[model samples]
Target: MVIINPTISTQPAALTRPAGPAPVLPADRVLNAVVLGERAQHLYELSSGSLRMMAESQTPLREGEQLQLRVLGKDAQQRPQLEILQRGTQDISPQLRNRLPEQLSLNQLSASLNQIRQGENPTLRQLIAPLLSSLPRRQQLSDSAGLQKALHNSGQSLEAKLASGEAPKGDIKAALLKLLATVQAQSPPPPKAGLARSYGPSNTPSPSVHAAGSAPADIATPGTASTAKSASAPQPQAASTAPAYQAPPKPLGLPGELQPQGRLPPSPPEIEGTLLSRLAHDVKGALARQDANQLLGLHSREHGGSYMIELPVRDRDGIDVWQFQFQPPRTERDHSHNERGSQHDTTQTGWTLSLSFDLPGLGAITARVTQQEKQLGIRFDAVQSDALELLRQHTPELHQRLAEKGIDVAGIDCRRRSAQALTESSYSLSALLRDQA
Candidate 1:
């Protein structure tokens, strides 16, 4: 049986301070890691070369699991803290395959644009030649202007081509797709200012019509001799020579069509609502099936929002009761006022996911996982030190279970909290769920 020390002292060693600055690890720096062993409070001792440090994780790690970790910062004793970034090498292949098609299209567009920008006389006509015949007959008359201009600029015999009727229709659709991608990659010129109107015959004022007394009284007094004379004059026959406003030339592609930007648009309300609904349904299904594996996959802590899931996993000791609570996405409005009537801002973008479990011999345990920006932090309640110590002994198993559900265990922290505080926290979560129901 493995026994873990209840507490480890972390005070600075008694020595004169080194001159200059403390050597620090770069933030979010990635390092390859291998699990060495487990220590107190579910912490795993990890190594990279001569560097050895402890990391706390909710997910268990096997004795020799290879992993990548991003350095967060140094703990109190100056040991580097790291968060898991990725696991085994093969894990990312499927995700890359899912995105391969889009990546390929983007690569092609980038290459073509780079060639054009370098002034290479690429076969512009040949590039779009196949697209000409596939255009709808009606759209051909309208949308074919850009194509015609491109061909003409390339000195290609467009009329002769039409006469020959040799355009390959089968490749037209594919050519159009490529052309669309290229156009989207290019940045269009800035829009021209709107037309300016010229007032006719500056020598004569245009007739000023207004509601009675709407203008200043002096301007409204048209009956005055000078005003009547000015109004009655033939207005110099109003030179009738205003320049017509001409619109700026439209870009080569469809007029007034904005090129698609790279960023994704926000999800529509219906889609967001559907996602939440589906998530609820999936969670319910997982629970009904009594599948811890499925339930683990259903926990979405990234997007934020309340989620509850039960994990029923048995170890050598007994069945453990695992409960998860995810705080709803908190917005700026949520932090505008605290009980003290002062304004505060929460810089954290990600929500919190709290895990609570009951170990047969170790009493209650709570682990709070928080992600701020890209950094991950895990904090355990200090009231249940024994539970955490016991967990440390089973670190490998815990890591494996969490990994099965797609959760990455990062740095672990232990903080003291009173029983009252735990109760208050649970109450808030309970209230949130009740309101949502």
Candidate 2:
């Protein structure tokens, strides 16, 4: 359409009739879109969602090309207007951006759970037990089927799984959600500000409370001592300044108040809620990072069949996480990556597999394997020199196993791990259970 100030902007007006109702996105929501069809006659179809007539873009718009846009509210005809925000899918979602700074870590959560497990509440313990039991054992990841199950339980695609009516099994995110809600339900709420203030500002303790081990029997007059024992006991210290938690009349998703918070509650009920809230924050943070990686796979220059999965396995020293990524081969019509221009390849029915994990003896290791036809090429990057040597020693057996699977081993190499190849446990997730397992 019309290009102004080097940006492609469009006024989405329906050609035949008024523009139809489009999907409602927040005014600041930014997303990516690809040109599916060729541009012709300068006339465009104003779709209800992704509204567009004359689109504003920084880059030249062509078929199969992708550009980013930010929702800018409705236009004169009440049609949505999207201003091109960036040129690629690399721009992370604002919701995710806000979450990154405040998110918690699973390592910390495991420690918190250990402390929380000491509580005497059998009901709370029941909720926590399933989560620990669901963790896969070290031996489970030895087979392909077990590995598949781990990937399925990562809890990234939870909403999609629930929406499809195919319940996800052992989804960690779903477990976190349930555990948080249950803990919140059972938690002993802290003292309310108004109720505490009514006790008066005098130095003597309130008549209703007797030091640390007392409960109010009946309401006493403000600033007046009811008994001799109450007059000698310490008066109510300044009421706790921190805000109190209130149960929503009808809860939606996790509230902002539940985000990973500081200071544990005094009672068992409160402690359970605090620990579970932190755990949920860490798990959901991983989900957000997984979503970002997936968005890149879809809108990046690659052929767009890419995935990242994180699996947490139970080991002798608590939990060890493993990461895996799969990328499908590119096609002839694939868009050029950066300045390389178009790459013409007729035969690319291959795939790439990458996995990173730390073992008892191997330390941190990342393995990348590319499969073309029946042939395979693999490279192992190990952080420790001893680990690299050990991996090299195992290559012969690894090659032998591939051959047994009818795979032609082209080459196998081991090298020191680089920063780029090093993987963290935070950004990997897959399935989300529809209901608690």
Candidate 3:
């Protein structure tokens, strides 16, 4: 009877209490930021050398522009340090004032409006950076004025840049914003998307008249195509549920419930081929004329000495058949190559060409044709396995050398080593002709 029960914990009461309802989030305020482009600006300074405003007020503005406007405090090095205060839109135009949507917070409106202030930006990038930053935050804003401001900023920036000698930056944000504003301002919002009845005098029908209960004769009024069609053609009885002004079941291609399906048929092959060929021809011409100077110009980075013809050989017909090749070798070795050689063996590469040209015609024509061959070599303690294989396949001597270095000749890719012994130990008949010349 004296044993204490160990069932209940001491903190049981604390764990039983209920938590309060989750806190509600505050509603987001609407914002509108104007779109703009970066551009150069002419700034005005007071006699004290404090930036008063931008010299050109026609350009779209940016946050950097405000920096340009502020008086700078001297730094430790006596360099000007920028300090900026936020600006509002009391000085903006009335049209823009009217365009500002009432739902936007004052801060949002001011921020948006200030982005397009004239004379503030020197570059479109500077002007539009703020607006571009705001796009990812669009859901936070609630009003159309922000949208309008963005549009106005973009349009003004584009116009100013165009008037200036500088090219347009083709900023997509500005373009889109201006386009949206133009559409909103020029095109009326679509009529509310429902059946709207216009009220008029009792004798006059509603603007959107419907005759749900009317007979065919009642439905088709005089001086109308419907009336004439009903009179001429035997018409099926209209559906009981359908109104007299049910828009005649919408003709083919009209937007309605009965939409045709399946994708459009393929274009004709002949027409497509002709168009493609014409386009190819046009592209060839354009490519041919494009940047003619670039074609003939030498690559600046690959500078080497020029090549010139020395002796010209002509045929019996007075036409030039061939010319001697001459190029002045570079006097100095590349410094970069010397550095690389410190770490690795410097590989020497060179090319030689064997050429013959034919001149067959009457006026001292010399018939010549040219063939070219190239050889490359590198000095290494051990060549790459792939290259060694090629050498072994080409030359037994190279394979034997590789074997001396403990490499297998049977595993090689080449027929044999590339080097060859002199043939007949004498120059060929063609070489003799060139030597004699």
Provide backbone clash counts, one per model.
Answer: 6, 11, 50
List candidate 2 stretches off by more than 4 Å.
Answer: 1-92, 114-125, 188-277, 280-305, 331-349, 418-437
> What do the candidate models score in CA lDDT, each in turn?
0.38, 0.50, 0.25
Q: Residue 292 error for model 3, in Å? A: 41
Weakest ten-residue segment in model 2 by summed lDDT: 250-259
Best by lDDT: 2
Tens digits of lDDT, candidate 1, 113-201: 22333333344434433433332232232345843433232212222333344353333223434455543344232123211111111
Candidate 3 wrongly placed segments (more than 4 Å) = 1-55, 58-60, 64-164, 167-171, 189-437
Per-residue CA lDDT of model 2 for 259-319, tens digit only, reads 1111222223454444554444444444444444444334333435455555566766556
Off by over 4 Å in 1: 1-305, 333-348, 382-411, 416-420, 424-437
Candidate 1 vs candidate 2: the lDDT winner is 2
Best by TM-score: 2
- Model 3 C-alpha lDDT versus the unseen true structure: 0.25
